[model samples]
Target: MIWDLFVLIFYFLVVFYFGFHFAKNTQKEDDFYLAKKEIHWVFLLLSLVATETSSLTFLSIPSLSYKGDFRFLEIAIGYIFGRTIVALFLLPSYFSGNTISVYEYVGNRFGKSPQKTLSFVFTISRLLGDGIRLYVSSLPIAFLMERMGISISPEILGIIALSILSFVTIIYSVFGGFRAIVFTDVLQWIIYIFGGIFALGLIVNQIGTTTLLEQIQHLETLGKWKVFVFDYNQTGDNSYFILFAIIGGAFISIGSHGTDLMLVQRVIATKNLVSGQKILIGSGIVVFFQFLLFLCIGSLLYVFYEGKSIPPDKVFSHFIISEVPSPFLGILVAAILASAMSTLSSTINSLSLTWARDWEMDKWFSPRILSLFFGVLLFFASLIPYFLVETWEKGILEMGLTIFSYTLGPSIAVFFLAKDKQNLPISGFVFSLFFLFSIVITVAIGIGWKLSFTLLVPIGFGCLYGLVSLSRFLKKN
Candidate 1:
């Protein structure tokens, strides 16, 4: 206990120090909002990694990996190609436009409807998305403490973690804002990178080199690590799904990678197009492999505990609590805390910036007022743990991922098509928006549907509607 306390103190101090470090220099909206638009390519790379390698990714991807090797990777492959498209194609428009909120550019390109639609969608999606992200990532810590006889319920555990996270986020975000978030993210990158790598080494050290290979051979024997799921048998995984994913995956990436303020702010902070583009591309390469390391760690955990009655998602936590040696336990705790807090802080700061900038909610409500409302709303949302622990567990895991599809997919489609000189009318935006929501309703009825499928069903109809409407408009004009 003394050791854990000391470790937590060290972790807290490192992050807070950086937050305070930048707060001193922040003096205006741009500084707090866009890091004064002065971050270099290096910081952009770190921020890009920080935005994705959030607490959620750290917790959930390993769970996914422990379940099956390529399921998460399959999604990630499609996602990464989308990132490449954003880096090369869409990122420059930020430079050309010179606005902080990327959605603001949409309003200029298509119309006010698109801008407001995109902004509101981001708000709704992120609240749920980041809320679950906050709740689930910290679950491991709470669970670990319980196993160590700390005596706490998951509900109480959820509050404790959310409180600590909220405090850190509020403090830093109110103090320094964007520069603080970006600058501090680099520090988090170091901690997460080193911590995960250290765990990998320690796991390997416990199992000798020859023995590790033997374990890997065991995995090969069991057929756990294949890269591709190609089914030439015509009934295996289905190629139509693959083709849809490849295309739709890119679209999802545009919404997440290009349109997300968490990332757009980072790229906008860069000095020029070339530097920003390289950082965006380089970050994609780092990101693809970052999760690979987590998946590999999941693979190692399988070998270490060859035949235990346990859950796949719990493997990493189990290793920490029961199997990981002490002393390094302190380092490991610090790493988990870093992953959890950095993600929370960055996200909180992001939501703050997004609302404070995009909504101009400041015109109506004070920052403190908005914070109070958000802090309360999120508290309720985090209790999703109780439900998750109870009857809600299943194969879907789509609630958090799919919420973005309704509004985000259409907004992204409009932006992607409209930006490179494609013409979309005010009414076209209306048609696309209508099509998006109707699909979201049916998708709810058909739970377990993938985001790609849900999004495509609407987008295809929206495109057809757009073309017909455009022809009618041409005739009238």
Candidate 2:
């Protein structure tokens, strides 16, 4: 245990070293935000994979697969199609504009009011959504604390974990800028993937090939390996319905990869249009395989535990702490931290970038100052989930994705409206109203209809587009 803790502490220091090393080169705002537009495609690809995954992918995905089937892969398959569209259509516009914040396009296609509003929306959504992610990432730490006889409430532990992560991430991010983030993300991607691979190998080595095959056969018999859900209901959380998965996944992917600045920021930071497109499309394939790895870990875990009852979130963490050997266990915990920080750091940087660039706040505040400011907000925002865990029944991944879909649905519609060159003949006030309505409908009203959160984007877009078109037609008449 002592050795493991030492390794974990050493890893954090290494991360800080990388961040500080890169800080010297970040001379201006553009360099800070876009990495001087000099990032290679491979680093961008690794960073995208690392940033898009949070503790949710590291911890919760396995739980999801343990309790459910591999139907989530269907959504991953849809991700490939969704990003393909973004690469082909959205990348050209983003690179041509050369703006720091992607929302600038929203301003250009819509109006200045909408641009500022979108920035505000991005800030709030990231604060609330990534806040949940920050908290989820800390769950394993809470487990670690408990085992070490550090008796504390999960809420306090969550705050402590978030603080530690935020502080270390901010130091490098404040200094290193975008270049540091991309490069560190590549390092983190390797660590976490190694952790997953190592854990899987340990599981297989213990179980032996015969036992592994038998377990696989048993899982297949139970239909646990089923990948597609043809249900017409469309209301369930994991509905793998053919059209529902593909269409909803496409819209969500487009919304996230294209409109959400957290992801778009990465692609835009790449060298040029072609490199950006390759990175965007390649990430989808990588995610598909990554999900496969974690889900298989979950399945093998099911075999290891012999189907014993375990809390969904605790499954992966429990194994690492109790089963794995010393130094490797420490390394795996570091990987968990890597997964946590990758998203948190990106969230902090992207939020600062949008506030500084989109709202034209550069005159008032530097990117580093703005990053520190938002980092504080994101830290507080992360504490929210400690209180919410009781009410949230779905796994961490589902809840996070749903919150993202609801909050960002309107923003996605606005992007689509911009793309199609359809003028929204409405005030920012009216747009905000419908935007809130989309969230209300998805969470509150969709309850009765049983609408899955996956469909929220397309539904929200359709509703917004229809209303805006009708108003425009009436004005013409």
Candidate 3:
């Protein structure tokens, strides 16, 4: 236990070193936000993977496979298709100008009001979505505290964890900026991936190779290896049904990768259009394989536990705490922190950039100041999940994805609207947003429709576009 704690401390020191080291180079807004547009495609690719993976991927994905099968890979399939669309269509426009925020393209295409509105939407969505991610990341910390005999309510423990994670991340982010974020993300990606592989190897070693094969075969018999579900029933919210999963996944990808400033900022920071396109599409493939690795970990975990009735969300964390040995356990815990911090840092930087650049807040205050302010806001925002976990029944992965689904659809819809030659009035955009929100609230909360969360993206896209078009037509008539 002592050795494990030492390892985690050492890891944080190393991350801090990277932050201070990079601080010297981040002297201006461009450096703080875009890394002077000098990052290589390979680095950007790794950063994207790291940033998006978060603690949810590290902790929850395995639980997914442990409880069910590999149907989640269907969404990964849709991710590839969705990213392709973004590469072909969105990348060109993003690269056509020297905009810092992705919303700039919307502003250029439509007007400033729409750009600000989109940025605000992005901010709120990222706050809520990544806030949930922050909470998910806190789970392991809370568990570790309990093991250490730190007696406190789970909520307080979560707050302590959030404070530690948010503080270190904010410091590095304020000083190091985008370059530091990208470089550290690359390092973090390696740590967590290695940790995951190591955990899987440990499980394999414990199970014995021959027995592992038999166990897998037995699992196949139990339908645990089922990857694709072709359910045709559309009367209910079957998210994993092949068509909904694929189409919904694609739209989600479009909204997240193409429209969201957090991921888009990485691609836009690359050298050229081709580099941006390469990294964007390449990330989807990498993510697919990454999910495969974690899902397989979950399956083997099921085998290891001999079908113990473990809560899917707690499966991996439970394994880490109870099953894994000391110092190596610390390494895995550090890996979880790595995943969490990477995303948190990315969120801080991206949110700061959007606020500073889109709203022209940079004119009033320094970039570092804005970064600090948003970091604090995000820290507070992350604590929200403590109040929400009781009412929410799904795992952290699903919750985070659902939060993104709420805003991503309309945000991406605006981009699609931008492609039209006809000017979409600001009033029309406002009305469209209102319309989309009403439908989302009605389906998701008011009536509690069984609509799949995956479909939210497409549904939102259609609502926003349809209303915008109708508004334009009505004005013309």
lDDT computed for candidate 1: 0.66
| lDDT tens readout by residue for model 3, 50-123 | 99999999999998899899999999999999999999997898888888898888878766777888888788
Give the TM-scores of the predictions, in the order they appear. 0.88, 0.95, 0.96
lDDT of 1 by residue, 132-227 (tens): 766766665676567667677767876786777667666665666677777777877787778788888888988889999998888887767865
Backbone clash pairs for candidate 3 read: none
Top model number, lDDT: 3
The residue pairs found clashing in candidate 1 are: none
Tens digit of lDDT per residue, candidate 2, span 295-335?
A: 99988888888758888777888898788888888889888
TM-score of 2: 0.95
| Model 2 RMSD in angstroms | 1.8
Cα lDDT for residue 163, model 3?
94
Candidate 1 — worst ten consecutive residues by lDDT sum?
Answer: 231-240
What is the lDDT for 107 in model 2?
78
